[model samples]
Target: MKYVILIHSNPDPWGHPTSRYTAEGRALSEEQHEQGDRAFDALLEEISASGELVTGEALADPASSTVHTWTPEGHLATDGPYAETKEQLAGFFLIDCASRQRAEELAAQFAGPGSVVELRPAMWSGGDDQ
Candidate 1:
């Protein structure tokens, strides 16, 4: 099965890899931040070696995002994210795992104090016609 791990976080003073240096990131102790980084690195290495990691990437700031919506007149373009929530999608990891439980286990590693992690099965993965 293929799953996508969606990572969401507050975009104000956004920082990468669990918001290590931002004000929100500062909520954690320095030791906790370092530990998170090490854990993330270990997870990446493990998944890559197991051939479960298909691809992963971090997104640009929400301020650089553009939203497009279809309308009767034409396509409408907006300046920011599609949602008005405090947390916005910050990154994602696509993985080919053995089962939903296994995917969930991996997804848990991405969650932090304030970050939100979502795991969803991919209906259409790469090289699939149906």
Candidate 2:
């Protein structure tokens, strides 16, 4: 089974959990940064050993992102992100596992602190051999 994990933030439990989901800063604390790096590093090692990490990447800073709209002439460029939301796209990973349970386990193990990871099967647009 293969899966794609969409990394997004979720509500923090204590303050304003409903309308106000506390946003984890794009910049992590020194300890958080170290912990994240170590966790991801271990994840990568595991994936590599299992031969399941097909492809993956950490997105560039949202501040650097370009929000563009299509125009008749060409692709129109704009500044900033694609949407205004409490949560934002952080990064993603694609992996193949033995089953949904396994995928969920991996996702659960790697999910960032105070974040939501949506795991789903990859869709195929064309039939095999297409």
Top-scoring candidate (TM-score): 1
lDDT winner among the candidates?
A: 1
Give per-residue CA lDDT, model 2, range 9-117, as digits (tens): 5444323211133355334566766676788789889988998888877665466788888888999888876768756666678998888788888888656656678
Mind giving the per-residue lDDT tens digits that candidate 1 earns over 1-47? 88889998884577676576345677888898888889889999999
lDDT of the candidates, in the order given: 0.84, 0.68
Cα lDDT for residue 116, model 2?
74
Clashes of 2: 0
Q: What is the lDDT, from 0 to 100, of the residue 111 in candidate 1?
A: 84
Per-model TM-score on C-alpha atoms: 0.88, 0.67
List residue ranges in candidate 2 displaced over 4 A: 9-39, 71-74, 127-130
